[model samples]
Target: MKNLIDYKDDIYKCSRCGLCQTVCPVYKATLNECAVSRGKFNLLNGVIKGDLILNKNLKKYLELCTGCNACKDFCPSRIDVRDIFIAAKAEYYKTNKLSFKEKVLNSYFLFKLVLIVSRFFLPLYRFFRVNKLIKYFENSIKKMGTAAKWLILLNSAAGNGYKPKIRSGSSLKKVLYFDGCFNKYINNETLNSVKKILAQCNVELVTKNFECCGVSYLNDGNIDEFKKIIEKNLSKLDDDFDCIITDCASCYDVLKKYKDYSSDPKAVSLSDNIKMAWDLMKNLEFEALKSYKISVHKPCHDSYEFIDLVKKIKSCEYIEVKDYDKCCGFAGKFALINQNISGKISEQKAQNYIDSDVDIILTTCPACLLGLEQGFAELKLSQNRQKPEIMSLYQFLSSVCKISD
Candidate 1:
């Protein structure tokens, strides 16, 4: 919960290197210096010295970021750009009144209500082409000057009810599995795949009732809600397990931050045990399936360990795209809040995959799956080209391991 003032030194550490311009997805999309870290840092520095005031324009400039941490990684000084932006966003929200739509979207109760309603009515909605109705509603919401178009897009992309059955195993090594909000509500096929693969490796998997990792809340500048959910998750996550596993790269990133965000001793232990499911799968011996060329979309939070695992699969041919490590422009809420910029970036990534002529496009993050899907859909309409199937690394590995559905 550090304020912008707390990050003054970190802000000044930026030497206006402009190296971030080369890696920043939003900056590439908008070509606005304010969209990059160095530019944002300069504005923030001015705010600290009372030369500039925090206004709607400044807030919008900050919101332009995708929270991919690319600038932080590319910085010569290794300045923490994401931390500063997040803190500044939190501070901005503290003084400003949240809009009705923002409050409703970030409310835990409303989220639960929407999840329940979607699960119950999604089939009917899909059958009836509810997106048209949503579009009509969007017109009204837009008239109200709120960004409800994101809600419309999200509703259209909602998955059909696909819950995977959880299986247990008897093994010496104990692992707790954290199914992120996307896996828990929209799709569980990937979670089931993780369980099947882990069972094959003789690792016992444990399940618990965990809340959203608060990454969404943090992105929305709802710090209070984020803290509330984190405390709840920490209470449920005890130190009994040898490792806490997640297939979602975003959840992995957020869970690892709990150590710095909280004072609870379990927070550190839980963060320390946060392991990527693919990291475990890489070492296990498995018979690779029949050969198929595949391209990977490495998630922003990924350490590329999953890419190495994909390469190890026996008969499969791995095709590398030129922008393999670039952001898919779907950094959670970033896709929703900044759809135009997000769509432009996704188009670039998707076009790269389409040009590769790979049979499948693989990624580790569910959000990326949605983003890539959106991109392919847009391209398919414009170019009328045959698009490759987008699958999760878990799904690809499950197929290679021949795990039954």
Candidate 2:
């Protein structure tokens, strides 16, 4: 994985036709020659053929990508650009070494340690806008010569946000909520809404401490770190709950494909579980949900599975938008590291929904929520109009459905 020469053949297949440029969010945002796949491909090819060594410029080009898979989606030859970049990072880190911040971020023990330490300062941290302070810290770290500052900032930013109060209750069916690190740290509203929806279906929510799903690290081509975290997560489960649910599409996508030594049953996404639960509750009579213009933003990871469910739901009339599976530009750290490109991709998705005139835009992933909201807000600001509300499928269903004990 550390050898750049190994990918020479794989990368040689790239035609450099610039199809990737058309779909690349960062390229669209920065307009820099190096931000697009074509530019990165040329750089990597040069390195592989011994014309150039892995350098800061190469890293910058690699880092510009969000690993969102859009270029791969549109590529004629279907080269794995994201995976290739991840491999490049692993190769680069092997020789240049990871910074202390990256080393800490890459270490599960340290990451969890920071989360524990941050919890104690939650009130005061919120009072002083600690997250904003963290942004400055990361900026300083990057300025002080740490390549991993962006990663630290993302971890710190995720830590600064609100957490959900996991409701305690006794119910018939017990569930293990695989609260991915970010959802637990930042987007607790999604967790609460999911819990409320599950409760309506007579399900009890429970969770044991779980490790990061390692999808982010996987994108970095750190297979050792990815496998280490995956194993750590598998060990924490005692197998008491019937079903496991996750709200993050990326986490769900990763965990569903998780092949640990233990071979635990695959985890289900919250949307899939919700659709199943909704089917069980559909027989119960309830007043019709009010009709309103609504659009469903199906994330690329979960869109195929969710599309059928979208078609089957009766509560809200579904309005379809073109290219609904386009990446929302928030593939975890993609937007943070490549803000300009991410913003453009996000704005495009937002415009799709706005043009449809949907009252509420429903999506499943938290990243999509942020990307869509940011896009909608920017578009709204541009037009001097209001942005549409964003809601999760589970959250929307929980608001409308009635539960019978």
Candidate 3:
């Protein structure tokens, strides 16, 4: 878990090829050389060589990256450029303590405390139009040059309800839910839907006493804190489970970072398990999903091995959007911190949806849902059109298939 800047060999191995430019979403939006992997590489090299100090201005350039992993996927060297950037941020944050906001975010106890308080103050948010108030607070954070965003988030927990908790039965098939912070807070419905889908599959769910998946902490470059959270979660999860389920791609990707699982024989995302079960059900001549006109936003974390599943389902007329594998701009903190560039990448994805002529836009992760929904909102405003509905792949499946008792 060394700082990404510490990857001298990987950083030095980068040939400044600029091949990452073709697919980098931020670079496409801002058209700034500094927004892509190569530029960031050069900047980090300067910092390492003492040509540049790791200051806020320099940090902002690194922060502009979405950590979408697109660059690494395309890199000939496969240098893991995204992880390096994340490590660099962690290294920088080590030298520079957490900002007032980040300090609150990284603490589980404080976050839960804020959630408790939010439950009591729910009406106040509703009375004043909370979502707009949140946007106002986000804007205010920018205007006042203060850490109001974290304070606002502290107040806004009840707006989405508390971090979702799953109730488990004593003895049955167990499933672990990797509820990343965002899914716990914003996309509670998907959590609920996952429970329902599990019930239909006859799999009993278990709620592990776990911490956040550390994706946020990892991106913030608080590696030590991130490691601590993962270790704590690993200690709590001693029971056996059929599989681990999560509704966020970024969280799913980060969960794999845990060395504790290096020994576990089985671990898979909820969608992955479903895709496997889907094959079994298909062999049974189960009714195909016929009512929906849908398109899938294959998350970057979903194995490319599953792309054949897409091909299999394609015969049912499930529309596939072009460039669907590209990141949806929900790289945790990236969406919040780099709004304009993030929005542009999101708009492009939304535009693909509009052109696809589908009733619903489907994705595997909750963050993608939020990012795409926001993009659809922007597109609607621009064209005076209504936005398409956003749905998790589970919800889409649950809607089409009836659950048996």
Candidate 4:
């Protein structure tokens, strides 16, 4: 792994342009230059020059980022801002001793344990409206500590751990399906939909004992753990498959960037074969539906041309929302760390969908689904209006393909 100083040139490559400010979700919410890429770059540059120390404040600046890559995407210089931040985070973790709370939150065993418990109690949790309960718990967790906040967020995001039974097809082209953590646990409907859609395409969908994509580890600055999980995942996949497909945009983005973080040859191979589920299904034949007004919340990590593909669908009328490309503010642990900002951004997105007056609000990312759902749920209580149904693109396509859940 490269150190922060190794990316000295990339850090300095920032032209100090403020265009990132316009698109940065955190910056838009906080209106703090320190929350944006350029400001962070300046701080990083200061650290390199020995003018500033990698202290708590400096670390907080890095944490303020949602890692959405919007700044990198909009950068005139095309600097990999997210990459630099990740490197900086790794360096900080290396030099500083992690608090007990940080260590516990980042523990693999604890995460898996929480997942197991959450899955077991999912029915009861939903019955009590756990999503609604999270808002109230947020304040108390903040008062407790950062560790509590992590626990609350992870609990809130836990899914029912439903596994869809996907029957194999007779196609020679084998596509390995990587059901990301969110889809695997909470949103199995999306996975089932993907399987049915792929079956229609005459492609064999394969699955093996795969682990989490280690995105949460990466976001939490646990690079060592992230690499370990990625190595485990790589061992499960082989070159025999035609392509590796993922429905979650964030997972797709992280898988695509695996090569940059790890030197493992398999990481490069795995990333090379990664295909966004929407990219594969858009060209396939499906029965068109009656005209329905639909709005899309494009995930910040969306790299494929899914929106254009959605537009190509004949039956559904795509309603355009103002600032459609804005972040839904569910940047993994970011929503937990900065709930106020996250809630504000999510509410703004929900308002856009409400204003569009659509029958359904569709998104490509699983985490975005949670954010949109929470936002719409809050809107329902406060505004007393009908909240549009939130569905994954896979769900929408499944309906068009007439796949029963």
Candidate 5:
């Protein structure tokens, strides 16, 4: 992993262009120039020159980012803002000792523990009709605090799915599946949906024990922890599989970059064969069970043009909301750490979807799904307005669409 000093050149190349401000969700919400890339580059540039020290105050400014890479994509200098910030954050971790709160916030163990608890209680949550009760008392919860905005996201695990019309055929493709931490821990609805669709295409899935993609660790600049998990994942990567597939955009993004972290030959081969499940579902056709208006929230980690696939669904009308490709502001821990900024950004993005009057809002990543739900929940929408249903794209498809192929 590279250090902050290594990105000195990239920091100096900022050119003080304010173009980044145009796309940064943080800047849009807070209007803090320091919250954007140009401002961050200036601070980093000072640190490189030894004019400023890396302290918690300076580090707080760096954490202002969503790691959405919106500015990176829009940059005229084409600097890698995401990696530079990570490198800088890694620098912070090197010198400063982590506080207990910081440890819990960054702890993937505790994060997964929350999901494990959720999964364990899901049966009781459903059997006692707790989900419905939560929905009934949702408005009361929202009044309690901003954190309560997660009510929709927390209750999202249970939903209806279409019955599989076809059985798995003789294995034609040796596709290894990478079910992300959210799917593996909370529920497998998204993975189940992908498998249902993949079976229609006659693709047999191979499974393996895999850890969290270490995206949070990477974003937190916990490079050592990130690489430890990366090395472990690279160890289990089978070279014989025709391709490794993922339904989560964020996981796909991280898995595709495995070779960047490790030079192991398996890492290179794994990156070579990394594929989004949508690539395999191209020729297959699906139709919604009912006529409804649907829209999509493009995940920041997504590189695939799967929106074309979403638009191709028969019977369901697809509406393109304004700035549908913008970040949902749920950039993992960034949401909790910067709740006000996140809530502000999500509110505006949610309004766009509201204006379009979409019945269902689908995204490829679990975090994005939560982000959308957070946006809607925080709005505490009027009784007159209907909040669109939020779901992972695969879950939405498998639950509402049938294998027309």
Candidate 6:
């Protein structure tokens, strides 16, 4: 429950050296000084000194950030820009009640509702060759609109018909699986893929009724709601498990921070066990089933240790494209708030992959998956040429690799 005042010293620590401008994706895309952390810090410093107002317009400026933390990582001050921005947003949320339209548009409940409804129709989306149909009409669909383009890409990914080998093995390590909202509601492809791989490794994949990782709530400065989700998730944990595993980078990032928001001592213990599923796979071996070229889009919040493991896969050639570590520009709600800027960043990123001409573009976060979809949708593909297929790191592996361990 720290306020913006708590971040005053952090704000003033900004040296105005503009190094943040070099790493910020939004600033790179928009070239707007206000879009970067150093610039945002300057405005915050003004507000702290009582020279400016923390008003709605100022909140809009804060919204420009994608919560990528690139600047925070590169800053000499090591300022936690994400937390400062959240504190500032919370300060505004204290007085600025959301309008009904804003509430509905940003509603987590509605977002879940949409996913639930989509899940309901998943059988039909797949039964009728929805993915192939979309592929067949790619050029025409591109003209429908941006949302349509993103829909086709994301939906095609889930139903893309890549099947992993079903393996049989005995259980050994006990790990609770945190199936994120994307895997739980929209599609189980990633979850199913993880389960299959772990099964081969003789790992007992435990399940629990864990809730969303509260990443959206935290970034929006809805700390109250974020804390509720964290506590709810913590209440589900115990010492019976060796560790907690998640495939989604965003979920892993937020789960690892649960201790920062809660007073219940269990939060610390559970957070200590937060892990990417790749941790278990690091010891296992995989036999490559394809000779395709592949590359990865590292999620902003990912542990990212899996990159080396991926490169180690025998037959898949890993091509390191330029700015492989840059943001995909779909920092969750940041996309909704700044669509033009977000699209520009994502499209620029997509062009990199297109230029590399890799067969697959892999990522860890579901939101980043959508950002890729959004980016490619903005492109006009050459006739008879399709963009590279997108997949979760594990999802692609499950299809192309078998645990030889």
> Among all windows of ten consecutive residues in candidate 3, which has the lowest summed lDDT?
277-286
Q: lDDT scores for all predictions?
A: 0.78, 0.65, 0.64, 0.76, 0.83, 0.82
Query: How does candidate 4 fare on TM-score?
Result: 0.86
**Model 6: pairs clashing at backbone N, Cα or C within 3 Å:** none
**What TM-score does candidate 1 reach?**
0.87
Candidate 2 structure lDDT: 0.65
Write the residue-wise lDDT of candidate 1 on 1-405 in tens digits: 689999999888888869999999999999999999989998999889999887767888888988888888889999888888888888887877777966776779988777667656666775686756764454344334224534544653554333344355557687899986766665567887787787777787787868778888777566787878889998898768778899988898889888877889988898888998888776675545677788899999879877877776667788998798988898877876787888889878888987788888888888888778656544533334556768888876765555421
lDDT of 5 by residue, 148-213 (tens): 666656776553322344474686776899876776766677778888778877787777867788
Model 4's alpha-carbon lDDT is 0.76
Using lDDT as the measure, name the better of candidate 4 and candidate 5.
5
Regions more than 4 Å wrong, model 5: 157-166
Error of 5 at 308 (Å): 0.9
Models sorted by lDDT, best on top: 5, 6, 1, 4, 2, 3
Candidate 2 per-residue lDDT over residues 1-405, each given as its tens digit: 335567777699999898898877778777887888889989988888789788655776788876667888899989878767878877877767676756765676776776666555554666777556755544334334223433443433343343334445667788777777755544455666667766655677676667778876776656677767766777776645455667767776667545521234432222133222233333333322776666788776664655555455556567888767777877765665666677677778888887777777777776677677556534534334455667766566556544333
Worst lDDT run of 10 residues, candidate 1, spans 138-147
lDDT score, candidate 5: 0.83
**Backbone-clash count (model 3):** 3
Q: Give the TM-score of candidate 2.
A: 0.73
Q: TM-score for every candidate vs. truth?
A: 0.87, 0.73, 0.77, 0.86, 0.95, 0.95
Model 5 TM-score (2 dp): 0.95
How do the residues 1-405 of candidate 6 rate in per-residue lDDT, one tens digit apiece? 578998888888888899999899999988999989988988988888999888888888998999899999999999999989999988877868787865775576887788788777776777788877887777788789867766675666556544566676667777899987777666778888888888877787887867778888888887777887887787777767768889888888887788888878888877788888888888777767878888999998886688888888888899998777889998887887788899899999989998998898888888888888888887777877688888788887787776677
